[model samples]
Target chain A: MKVYNISFQIDPDLEFQWLEWMKNNFIPSLMSTKSFTENKFYQIKVNADQSPTYTLQLYCDNIELWQAYQELQANDHLKELQYTWGEKCYYFCTEMQIVN
Target chain B: MKVYNISFQIDPDLEFQWLEWMKNNFIPSLMSTKSFTENKFYQIKVNADQSPTYTLQLYCDNIELWQAYQELQANDHLKELQYTWGEKCYYFCTEMQIVN
Candidate 1:
């Protein structure tokens, strides 16, 4: 399996409200697409900045499926996030290969 | 559950051999301590440097167990890795809360 992770650092002021929105709206909308088999969300404990950091992990059967999601759905989802939060949230994506 | 992640960026020249050592020795030794419930290894697909990066995630029921492992076993394990590989490998640690 492959894990497609999107890690985000959000403005502290919007943390609570943003988290609720993500859980109730954003993540559900993404999952509805059925491109992933499993998903996990996490708060990475690092104090690099005043903003809080979190990661959303979406697991799929293979890279091809994830690539397909990227081609078909990723841009829309990301666009929505950017359009909603703007500078309040910043993110980076990483593709990880499960070793064991 | 909590994930204690150790992320390493290793000299590309030692990638193959070091991976073999980690899969066969380091990870197993860490597991033997039984401080964690589950573990996963991954290579984050990023090309920020000449070195290749990998992560070892150890899952435990809580932070206390991980703290115990850090107090009793972590140092020795890290020392062994350092003694064996020296400047060939560099790493950082992160503690994360599973949100989903």
Candidate 2:
């Protein structure tokens, strides 16, 4: 299986709105792509720090599916989010091949 | 090899200081543990978001080495960082058994 992790650094001022949008809209739209086998989201909390961090992980059977999802992001739906979130969000994509 | 990921959500107000400390202090101490085979740090950027996010990944030959590093964190050096960073930092540890 291949695991892909995408992390977001969010502005504290827009934390609530970001979470709401991600939960209600962003994630669902990604899921609709039907390319992922498992998906999970994490809300990271810093002890006394006020910074907002969130992680989205998707598990796919292979890189092909992931590539397909990436291609779909070209659509208008994902583009809208890209513009809405703008610079307030940053993400990194890593491909992991599980070895146990 | 075993791959471990630790992510931190940092306060924007403490961004520069935090980065400096991690680069100079926390990370060096982690390296001193002498258990990790490879270590990397990533500074994540969010487009318009003001939040700060960082990730630390350690590669080990086995879980035992990882456990040793965890044990070392109990020392005074690591604790000092824990106290200094306090609530300003958040982290998650995930173990990945690479399968290619």
Give residue A91's lDDT in candidate 1 (0 to 100): 92
Retained native contacts per candidate, as fractions? 1.00, 0.00
Classified by CAPRI criteria, candidate 1 counts as: high
TM-score per model for chain B alone? 0.91, 0.80
Per-residue error at B83 for model 2, in Å? Answer: 24
Q: Write the per-residue lDDT of candidate 2 for residues B1-100, one digit (tens) a residue.
A: 6656776788888978988888888777777877777776776544557467666767778677777766756356546766998888766565554422
Interface RMSD of each: 0.9, 10.2
lDDT of 2 at B67: 73
Superposed model 1: Cα runs more than 4 Å off: none
Off by over 4 Å in 2: A72-78, B1-100
Best by DockQ: 1
Weakest ten-residue segment in model 2 chain B by summed lDDT: B91-100
Per-residue lDDT, model 2, residue B15, is 79
